[model samples]
Target: MSRLRTHYPLRATILEGRFFQLSENEILHSISLEYTSELTRLHSAYSIPEPDHPRPEISSPSFRIYGTEYDEVNRTLVGVLALRWIHFNDYESFVGCQPNSVKLRPQSFNWICNIYRKTIKSNEDLFTLITSTVINDLGKAPSLTTDYAKLTGTDINKVNHDMILYQVIHHPAVAETLVPSLTKVSSEHKHDLSLGIKLGAEFNFGQLAQAENVPACLSGLKTDLKNNPRAFEMRFMEQLLDIAGAAGHTDYTCARKLVEPIFDSYKNVYDVAIDIISGNLGLREGYDIILIRRVELLQRVGWKRAESLNIRDKEKRALMRLLCIGGAASIKTADLYYQTFTAVNLSRTVYEGLVEGLNVDGSLEQPAVQPTYLPAMCGLAIANTANGTTGEKMKALTALLTYLSRVLVIDKDSLSFKRLPEGVIVVERDLRQTIQPILESAAFKHKPDILTDAPMPRDQVAKMADGYEWSFTAISI
Candidate 1:
């Protein structure tokens, strides 16, 4: 046997400034003692690996005890399961406590709760819990902070109120619920809900339309446009003419399909104006023509129950203008004229009969509601200047701009009215200039990071950019 070299072992440092010199064997035994305590802690905290598990088995012999021997084997598998459990519990707690009264499954609730209980405790957990609880409870629908506060006892100040509202509005289930509600509400409530639903639906529908592997019919249309330009152009123009003619029909059933919700909304406004005018309630001098015109138009459209022919031709003309502006054509106009002239304001109170039938705000109250002249006027302005003078083209262009500006936020540079070689004035406004600003402004005012620059597909880009352009011809001088 080789002679053993004598080397002194390093002293062990312990708590409380205690130190001890030990032989090699003594040092090995001391390490083993601490290792055993740690192993016990880990074993108690986590589920032990099953014998059938693929990982290497834990064995005491695998741990090195000294220069020559090994001791306890497993120490790394300590707090993993405990940490995972805590995270899951935290997630569940967040989902469970949502303030919006949105219902969630018990299984999901329990799963997240268990994870939180097992994971590390921190403010992050509380924050998630609060947000999730609020969103879930609110039916996953966007609501005013005051509304949410009314529903959830939690103070609105405690969380990012705007973000919560945006999420609720955009939530799929909430949006779905709201779309139908928009159609059902009485006229007063219609304006508020309809505008909100339209905005949300347009955003969501655009996303759905752009999804990969869209249905065959829509995809076929996309392909035809891309592959056969001449055929596509002819077909598109034909379809446009057909739709416009269909939209202009005077029969109520035929017309309603094209303008039901909007017309219904306007009817509410007309009713309110009539009430205010008739009751001598809140009537001002400047509004007399407006009120009289509204009453005549309502009656002529067969919207009222009684009549009076004492209404003058000037008033009739004003009423005709109002009716035309509201999109009722010749037949509907005649009906309105006949109805309003015969019905008494007191025969059936306009407010009690019509305004009261609405839900929240008066008919004219919502921002998104537009006069019926909007679309037709826009189309006519676009159609008339196809071969006109530059000055006439410019006038039509200005009219188009004015129309769009009324409904959308527009950038000055994005408005481009160009005279084509064929002399048609083409108005080309970039939709991005109109729409992006709105999205950007909303995002910046709230949580700015939500606005993203993800690459959009070509078809999506086209749909988004559509209607931002129109063509017209001016009168030859």
Candidate 2:
């Protein structure tokens, strides 16, 4: 177990937005059989349907509708669902009351309600409901004052406040920030991995523990990885410890340091790829084909809006053309100097490399994280350059992890808001002052080809011509 940071955390998806009471069918359709069974059991026991994702120990879960908000990211109608807890006694009234006024709660309540009394805090100590039967004397009377969460036998409100603070920190999005990634090997160096480090969402240990099911149908992880000293459990423990350390729940750095030898000793996927990659990565060795293949790979993952480019523009335009074709929105041209297409593309190959890298899907507002540039570049740059100096190595190490274990919390309301490497260009920026002239020259260079028998948007083209400049530097034909 790791050292306690502030308080024991019980995390669940905290939803916020207007919510219509989902029909029985709607609710049942969304959840799994096990979840449906649990809900049924809870309704029978307390009349309240158990929360789909319950916050542990806090019973009688319910929700309230306030108003509606637009989901700009999802580009669809969406509603927020806030999690509410009804006290033990409020269960009967809560269940009996109409949906309209059911949002209200009991007046005389335990101090545990203090967690909900205030706006959740972003950072602080922890306080949770701790019911103790023992009686305490508060000057005038000997009474029950221990039902609410307490700290040092004093300041119950602060204790309650701390509990709210705990909720904020424990929120998956917030929790992800607390943890940092480790200095792991590069994707290029470790070739056999299928997916890079998952750093986008909350850590669901139960989901990861299911890695036991990842091995082939006939083989268990124990039998498959017999060649390695550390078994599946050991590898999982390392992963768990890394997650815990990054979430700032514990200081697993020392523990990680202790196992440095074992980690370094493990043979990775990249070890087997040395012979194969050496010849394939030489000068002018079908690099153009590689770019096409990368674009194909991008298309495989949903980036389909690609414009073909001739080899004449191949040297300066491959990546930028890919970027241009992919709709580089909010992309700093300086960051993507089109001059160094080959070097940049090579880096992409090295980064996305032999193993596929994880990319959070792209959107109009924020861009998807650069697929492999940040993570792979960081490790290779450090390993190749910073050999003797400890300080340099540590700096490089931190940078490497930042790229791998980078987690960005996304609103789960819609698929559009998810972070994945989406190849489609949502927002296209016209950085090319050259495009208008190119279009103008192409439009008028030779007689309007009007290859299509049907009418073209000549009116729209005329309107565009009024606003922009035109040049005929070179004829299209």
Candidate 3:
């Protein structure tokens, strides 16, 4: 068994309250006197033994008396005078304790009064004041009490007592300069000091926890979802779908494993559609409604990433729309452009699916095809129509009409087919008949001069054809 050591406790003595009702200047002088008496006693009680060297050999002041200097007596006297003046003015306003009798004026006197009232009210308030004061004073000059508190936990009692301890531990002159007229209560208020130490330790612990990984460890617990397999599956599916849509590889086995179960679980019409579109398990040979729905679902997840694929461009998109419009008529050549057509059509479908999923307004609209590309498609149609069209004359007419029609759209007024001496008549006639509907369209409605009886210039027509071919080839490549 261990025996606890007993320590002798210091007794507290209260100064007389005569200065309480005095004028502000008188009050300050009395308070200074009381502080001086307390300081004298503190200095004697905690005095260090005389050094082996002579008294004159000491470079700095050794004694702090009455919370003032012992060596620099003149400066201490001047500070005491200043404190008296401040107290005189502070005491005058509180003559009667009536409501609103004492109006607080801006100065050090009001600060003193505010501190007094708050410290007397609650322990938390006192702790806050002591902590703030020590931190503030330490910021200006180092204090041993504050340094000790920083290292080992310590509590501060009333503001006055805390201030006194602060001065005793640090030098009196420095403490006065940093926090004027502050002092700590005697050992009777040790409980207040202990309370402060506990609070301070807690505050420091919080800061340390944040600085280290303790908080991070706690946060990881919230975000880590190891128990939920469904969420894991969803995230995994999202990754695989993104890679597959990006044309990464033919690793359909991995994708099939994830998608098959989701399909079975949902078992909706849309889920079937997604399976068909993803090629996890192809349904009917041609593209169907289910395939379109799958594409729509993928689009709903990530449109920007999906759009980066080369197959999801304008020509493919237009062909998909044509299939949707023409149905079986467009399905015959589905295999020829299946990859390209499927990507475009699915992208559009995905976009619409996402918009619907999110309940956003406005339907997904298809982008318009440029007018210039129309002539090339028309030429293909014409070529297919010809029965054994083998003459150089027929080939020349087709090439000439294609060029002239493109130029007519780009430079309507410069239709000069006469530059070609051979077969100029057939080219001119074909241009007029082939472009008739285009000329009547809303795009050309505003340009009435283009449709008039103006024959194209021979030299200008040749130049425009050259420009048209360069642009067309550049776009194709």
lDDT by residue (tens digit), candidate 3, 1-477 = 011111111111112222223433332333334344332322322211222423322121122223432322222222222222333443342211212322222342344334345333444333222223222112211243444344444422212222334333344344433333244533333333333322222111111111110111111112222233222222222222222111101111111111221222222322332343344433222123322433343354443322332223444333333222211112222322233333343345434432222111111121111122233323332333224233322332233333333332322133332223221111111233345444434433333223333343212111111112211111110
Worst 10 residues of 3 by lDDT: 1-10
Error of 1 at 432 (Å): 37
Descending-TM-score candidate ranking? 3, 2, 1
Write model 2 residue lDDT over 1-477, tens digit each, in one string.
111111222111112211123332232223212122222222212111112422223211121111221111001001000112221233332223223221222331222133223312211100010000000001001111122123223222211111222222233443223211101212321221111111101111221121100001111122323343222322232232232112111111111111211121111111211211333322122223323443343344454333343334433233422332222222232123222232332345433321121222233333222221222232232343223353343333332322222222223453433432232111111111212222223332232221112111110000001122211111010
Estimate every model's Cα lDDT from 0 to 1: 0.28, 0.22, 0.27
Number of the predicted model whose TM-score against the real structure is largest: 3
Model 1, residue 304: distance off in Å is 20
Which TM-score value belongs to model 1? 0.16
> Where's the lowest-lDDT run of ten residues in candidate 1?
208-217
TM-score of 2: 0.17
lDDT of 1 by residue, 58-131 (tens): 32222333232111122221111112222344334222222232333355335333433443133333222211
Regarding lDDT, does 2 or 3 come out ahead? 3
